[model samples]
Target: MTADSSLLAQAREWHVLLHSGRATAADRAAASAWRCTSPAHEQAAMDVERLWALLGQLGEQPASEPAAAQVRPLRRRRSLRWAVPLASAALLVLALWLPQGAWMSWNADFATAPGEIRSVELEDGSILTLNGATALDWTISEGRREIRLYRGEADFQVAKDSTRPFFVEAGPARIRVTGTRFDVDYDGQDVVLAVTQGQVQASDAQAQPLLVGASQQVRWSGERLQPLQALDARQQLAWQRGKLVFRAQPLSEVFTELERSQRQRVIFLDQSVRDLKVTGVFAHDDPQAVLRAIESNLPVRLVRLPGLLLVSRS
Candidate 1:
């Protein structure tokens, strides 16, 4: 590991020890030495502090469980001495996994990092949950609540608006609602909609109206409105609830969903993997864990590039 990476590892281990309640006298001494090592040490600790701030914002329990700090019992055994270094190396890599996107709440806008869950309350007391890698422009003015989801998915629990309906515009389609909960997902070609609480009337800027009821979904593939069957409330809105449920979904599509929650971008290395069917219920964060689950269920191999994630047939 580089110097920066090494310091980060130490900083993460220190915090883990502090939180785990297993921090011994030796762990405290090591932290003291690390803090005074150099300015880089301070910087790494500050980085960890920043991460914790964003991580604790949405809820007390983080969706991604942090790595534990290394605390080897001071046994006089020599075999475990080698194990200590191995443990440190593993924890160091875990620190680098922290994504910067989770800090979006600290900004004027609201966003989630890869493997983060973000919840924001609007001016009208409604709640909005933004999935990882999702981007949306939200501005409430005069008598209108408008949001433009540029990409990814967002679930909105809209406050009441009679004259000025709560509106979400994704691509060419716009959904108009008044005091309800709904989800909007904008992919490249198709704009998807799912209503959770109240009724939603969706219409393209240049197309006919598509009415969707609670517990229902409708998709517009740029040409016509396709009404989908009624389904469970979790089918489309599960991500906000920290669950990802797939039913015979292709690996390519699963990778797209996983990209939102992973620090590393997962790219399919072969066309066969793209068409491979996958089904599971994975938590919204710690997407790497989801990949391990996939590997256990399917015939695949995962390769780590310098800054990318590649998946292929075994």
Candidate 2:
């Protein structure tokens, strides 16, 4: 491997060991030897360790970020009591995990306030429209453009950067593009990608590419991808407009939509109505309007309680 490639590989191994808690005594000694060999090596190892610490605290991260090591969340495993025991020696070995690395700055984060839409002017002068209540992190470093969506969503009007392909990550999927106008909906396990113009490819961090075209939408369920034709692209991205638009959308999808809009939380007493389809644009501010619309059309009942709303099949 080349010098840069070798360093990158070592960096990745260090990261996996630090997070997975799967590193052995031999591995640590080798890592320590590598860290002491050169300043660059030490910096790389410390950087990865620190990153894990910070991630445990906030469940968010970015490139070149200073990591906090003072706080490490306990590995949450309900079945840990049944696992093999490692005794005191294992605990003592981990005691040397000194807190190291730089603390990241707030300025490194890209956030948009609720009900406020912001546009980002990229280095290439291309515009990115950030929808309300969005938090994402991106970097253009070492001839690579990377965008990691920690939370919320973004509408990209990508400028062509063939030299450094623009990439957006949401949940388990990464979107790669040369240039395109697309909307990425990242709701944890499911990432719904819609391309209005140009083209983009969706894949896991290490998987084959799935090309998406104009007026198309696809979702990644971590293990596999399902493509759906754009029957209602507007509804797919109504959050950007402060509205939830549905056109003969399934009743289940409607409840999901209502849950997204309700300030508190909407609960459905009946799951049977979830399969029924409803069509309309419901103003987000007063979700009661949508309920009323649903009431006027479907054979259903709406029950409004303190801080919660319910949809039931009549």
Please report the candidate that would top lDDT against the real structure: 1
True-vs-predicted CA distance for residue 258, candidate 1, Å = 1.0
lDDT of 2 by residue, 172-221 (tens): 87788988899887644577888989888888765678888898888878
Give the worst 10-residue stretch by lDDT in candidate 2.
96-105
Collision count for each candidate, in order: 2, 3
Model 2 residue 107 distance off true place after TM-score fit, in angstroms: 11
For candidate 1, the TM-score is 0.64
Question: Stretches of candidate 2 above 4 Å error?
Answer: 1-108, 111-116, 122-126, 205-207, 228-232, 237-243, 259-262, 283-286
Q: Which candidate has the highest TM-score of all?
A: 1
lDDT of 1 by residue, 1-314 (tens): 11354566677778878778898889888888888888888877877665555444422322332335223543334345445444433433343454323333444355655666678898888888877777677888877888877667888888887977788888777788888988887764678888878788888766677778887888878645676658466657778677888888888878878777765556454557788888888777657677888889888998653224657789
lDDT of 2: 0.64
lDDT of 1 at 14: 86
Provide the RMSD of all predictions against the true structure, rounded to 1 decimal.
15.3, 18.5
Model 2 TM: 0.55
